[model samples]
Target chain A: MAHSSETLNPFENLRLELRRGCLVLAVLAELRSEQYGYTLRKALAEHGMAIDEGTLYPLLRRLENQGLLVSEWREEDKRNKRFYRLSPDGKLILKQLLAEWQSMNASLNGIF
Target chain B: MELLDRYLQAVKFWLPKAQKQDIIAELSEDICSQIEEKETELGRKLNEAEVEAILKQLGRPLLVANRYLPQQYLIGPVLFPIYRFVLKIVGLCYLVPWVLVWIGLMTFGLSDRAQHPSGSLIGALASLWGPLWLAAFFAFGVVTIVFAILERSQAKSRFLEDWDPRKLPPVRDPNQISRASSIFELAANTVFCMWWVGIRSPIIVLGQSAARITLAPAWRYFFWGFLFLAFANIATSGVNLLRPHWTRARASVRLVTDVIGVALFCWLCKAGILVEISIPTVAPAKTLEIANAINLWMSRSFPIVFIVGVVIAALDVHRIVRVKTADTRPLRGVAAAGGLPQQ
Candidate 1:
């Protein structure tokens, strides 16, 4: 299937929000192993979902504020990097959100 | 150093004063770390161009900083519901009259004209143009008065539904008004002088014909009175801005300005300055051509000027309310907690 840029236009903004929504789950799921900002962005992109630094940076801060994620700054190679990991609270929330997503998808598909 | 400086400038534009320095420091550290990672991945030193490109791609610094700030609404958090309500009611009032006028005009041709006897049934139905116009004028007057009263009462109440006063800047010392009043006086004088030209033009042109009982010189006085009132307002606003303590006096000045503006405008029509232009051309017809022309001009211009003045006054009131509310919020919050200490 050939996908054109025009076809992608309507989805562009929606895609960003949907990706942000899923990033909560993705970050929690990924940070089961610790990762820094650039590494996480690259990892997500490699999995066919590209996230910008602008979006990733704020989401990380907000998740940390909500106590669903924890971060620590470490000096490596003479550069300080903040590494984020999934808190126990983040893991629980991610699991619940995933379950909710699946149920909603099932119900919507059934109705359609 | 250059890259760090650019990043700091971006953050400074968005963040508040207290948090800006700390946020900049953290952002710089994060960017440096990202650059190192990028350099390692590419197996080369990242050039200035590449680093700048990455930062630019990060989007505006304000956009990034705004994510941390709470959401803002047009009417602000406190007045949002009330604002929506007032907007809906005002919208309905305007829409109903407008729709009725449109329907009446449109159906006039379809209806019987001989029975109506005014060429159009709508004109006959709306024969009492006097009462309809008066009702409209009264409605506008009541709305303006209500808005002004509500604005002041909201400031005084310091209710939870009202805006947070803390967010507004502190009122400057009242001394600022004395210095500012001179400028306002100049502006008011200029406007008045222009209007005086408009007023005196017909008298100069029409001479004795302009002085007839129907040609009221009293109409010209309203314009003069408006100019004087505008000058008084300039003085009061200047004094209020400069001295900071003359709240009541400043408000009264504003109220007087509004009243004079409305009165001068209405009387200008009633006195027939608007009719002056058409009277010379249409006098042979002598069939109310002058009055019709005057009505046409007023209907076209009055609503526009009235709306513009109301909007400007509303904005001024909003600014004043914001300032006053900010000053009294903490006290009100404390008072609310203490269970009604004072009137």
Candidate 2:
């Protein structure tokens, strides 16, 4: 069991790298509908794409920094919450990326 | 609410000053929502243990805060390998030598302390270690600062990209110059230079009170030459240790030193053993005959020594030019595994 765990480590690391690219795509795709951090995390988790709060928050900020997403703070449930949504640029990129993702998926399917 | 506030405060302490309030507010709202969701599921307000579990799940305050911070590196990934390389060289050149010097000082002190039982070995070690550690830290700081500047400027990555794979050192062969052998040569040469420098007279004592042969003044004249040869060997070895791939460079350096060594031997041969022997008044004539015979032997052996020196130098030159060319014949796929023997 310990040996299997040890061997799993490298695969786990590579899996994280694989998930990293997918996470950005998922976040961008979800934010097209506009949602706050907690709701966005919940929405993604419901769809079997669970992301940690730590990873989700930082990635949101980074995407915003890159001008692919825009964010605003507004009062919701008697408390101020920061809401994020895809920008015009992000929507354009999402379209292109989705196409790329589909093509890659198709190619992978053929191989498998 | 109180538990949530304390957790937020803990996290805020680690966040950047400019973003502290904004980040804390966002984080507080997220935690409250999570706790509310958990409470709805369990149908009760969370206890202290549940709150603690929630906070642990969020991760350590410092790590959570760090995720929000911009990625920072003193040496970025692009330049990290080179930075590590430079540090290793500095460690080899500075730290190793300093530690060796410290050990030498400690050995000398211990020997002295052997004479006087009251003397403290620990005190001697403490004194040397303090200064050596300070110097090592200073060197480390200087190298880090230099690399940090290079990183900030992004100048080194540009230089690194210009590197050619063809210039990569061939795979090392067992018989070729190695780090251990180079270090050994460097250390031996250093000790020889130190010994030569400290010598008041190069004396050869033959048995007990039989005869004492002191080298002539001509040996004194060649002190600088011998010292230079030793220093050259030391330097060549040092370079080889850092950049073992530069086989041609190592060969050239060895060739120059070998020529100098051969020249020094030729000078010694011309100077005729450079010695004066003194014998006791008892059996003075016989002792003088013995001394004359010894001198005659030295004169006869000089040519053989000179021939050997020439042969060694010639061999180094052949290895550098001919063997290197022969080995490089296959080119691309097959890199030469061996190099000239660096002795």
Candidate 3:
């Protein structure tokens, strides 16, 4: 029997909630190295964290808006692509966030 | 390439006007790259179906566009808890009570006409569902409108931020004030008060007979007192429903009402001949005999009723003192920390 797309799974809902913040963090960290939307998604997927272009593109725009990332249009391989990379503000935020994440991870590990 | 262009256009249609061209350009580039990657994997160019599959994987155009749009909620998550809390209170205080009263009045009316066979209770309930549902929907609409207004004005954040945990209500004791039981008691007391005040004669006719036994002059003599007592009981229950905390003022009010009730019953007992049985077909002797039996039973029962009221009054007095003392120093700390204090 085919399951309806709208049929709810609590686990999936929870996974979405858990992923929401983690996705932001991952995007911020990955933008430290310059990449366009497609290449960034491929890079994340290669490292076992696949992000959809829809999510990645919006996130990049949002981060750029927040001054956490910068973007520019450049011709690459005869096709125009919008490239995104971490801004100075983004680099500072990333350092603080990594420390916070490390502390949280260490505390979690101790508890486990 | 044409399929990808159409897909990007669909997404662009939903994007914000300022960012339309920029978003579409980026999306078009990404799709072209994905198609290139797919062709490399398959060792051939793709068909329309393959491109459509990629678009499907990207998700619905509106949903994909929503990620780029600013997050919007009619009632934002921050205020949702308060909205839910208010809705719950409305349900418990308003909707639940409304539903209970509907069912209760139906049952009360049926009980009076027990001699006649009414249709199934389920059928009666089914018939009542339409009006009940309409009322519920109206309540939901009002709540939604109120929350939507709050959201629009951005007043929800102010409400959340300004809230003080110190002013939170104390935990209610299950024994002292059961909301369901209080509501039921309030309903019964309301019905009784209405019967006493509104009706000329409060009597249930026995069997299918036209004859009825009505309350005697004694009831008339203490009619105002009976009403005052009943109303006081109703009022006390109401205040408790609105504010369930057990405090000195509340306890004092209940104690005074209960004492008046006891006194009223005592007066009725002393002023014998409470209910006069009226049966035109019956003999004078039989009528006197029935009336005497009823009067005697009522007079005998009044003291017991008085005693029960006294016990309740005593309990109320005890509660009042305890709560009053708790309001003072040392234990005042407890009150500060969400203890049962006067509203």
Candidate 4:
């Protein structure tokens, strides 16, 4: 079974790689509503895209690093929490990525 | 606290020791804040298990940290400095030897023909040229060494930065092993062996010997050696072209070629066919005797070394072939048992 699956594994891996860049866009779009890590994960999962906590946390940090997301620490009921929201730059980039995605999808759909 | 501690431990292991504490502090702060926000949303106190579960779902800490780390280049950052340093060192090493050899040769040339006035004068002038050439040669060596060192250092640094030690690919793939081409390997090894036999052995040995004997045309041997090396490189390129997927076979063939090359070099050293000037002085004779002893040791020991290298290479090739064969076995078995044609 594993032997037969090898043929398609590379193709599947490539498809995953193609989707990796879009992950940043997806995170930013979700964060526009002001959410924490677990909520974001749950939101993505609800949309049929389950992201591992391992993948999400670091991605959030990276987006924060790139100045696409703004984060703040808030304390409620004696518990400290960090909340993230989309930055102006993030919103602008999300718009661009969405337009690009739509155009590419249309072009690919036409060919297929 | 337990969830945060686990994440910190993972971060410390992944980051360099110098930066570990700082990174861990930052990560812990972020995780703590996130947990607080979640507890507030649920309208209850968070239990340790709930926090641990959330952290577990976050996946591996190293994977998360990698996303935040700065991108590093493979070759560009370090190569330049290392190349410069190596070039400088190589130039110096070559220069000193070249100058001494040139002076010694010129002095010998002049003394040999001292009784012939015009010949002696010509010999003295010619001797100076040898030393000058030696200096030039040393400079060239230094330049090349510096470049090579720089390139090597840069390659090492880039490899360290880009290559995730934890995520190393498998050492061997079955498909690659099975398809290893023996013909291409043999052809490459043959060409490499030919160059070692025909070009390098003769020039280095004959050139040194001829120089010692005050031969006027000995310098040509060095040129010949260079030409031969170039030809060998061209032959290697041709082999690469012919066997585009010969990487699997390369290690085995190279091992065999190295063994043959070392053997031939030892033989040439023993035969004295390459030596030019033989002086029967006690001290020089003792030096020659020492050289002979070393050569003898190499000649005797090399066969074992060569065999070992060849054996290892063969094993690697065999492993690859076995995997490839095994991969196709089930299909073949099914086809045979079912009386269906194999695809």
Restricting to chain A, the TM-score for each candidate equals: 0.81, 0.89, 0.87, 0.85
Q: Write the per-residue lDDT of candidate 4 for residues B1-343, one digit (tens) a residue.
A: 7666766787678776665764565456546656777888998878988888767765577766665566643334456456556566655555544444444334443333464445664556565666576667667666656556655775656554576677986444233323235455445656665665554333333443432332224334443544444455455445655543335345445444444544444344334342333444435666567656655554444434444444455665674465446546675454456544322
**Among these predicted structures, which one has the highest TM-score?**
2
All candidates: TM-score: 0.42, 0.62, 0.56, 0.39
Docking class of 4: incorrect
Q: What tens-digit string does per-residue lDDT give for candidate 2 at B118-145?
A: 3676666556667877988999899999
Per-residue accuracy of model 1 over B269-328 as CA lDDT, tens digit each: 444454434244345455366556765565445444444455556655655675466456
Give TM-score, chain B, model 2: 0.50
lDDT of 1 by residue, A1-112 (tens): 3334346777795776577677777777777789887788788888876777667776777788899889887876676677889899998898898899899889999999
Winner of 3 and 4 under TM-score:
3
Candidate 2 off by > 4 Å: A1-8, B108-123, B155-333, B336-343
What iRMS does model 1 reach?
A: 2.3
RMSD of 3: 12.2
DockQ of 3: 0.69
Cα lDDT tens digits for candidate 3, B203-224: 6466777677777665665777
DockQ of all predictions against the true structure, Cα-based: 0.28, 0.71, 0.69, 0.21
Residue B89 shift from truth in candidate 2, angstroms:
1.9
After best superposition, candidate 3 residue A45: deviation in angstroms? 1.8
The fraction of reference interface contacts (C-alpha pairs within 8 A across chains A and B) present in each candidate is 0.47, 0.79, 1.00, 0.32
Once model 2 is optimally superposed onto the true structure by TM-score, how far is the C-alpha of residue B217 displaced, in angstroms? 14
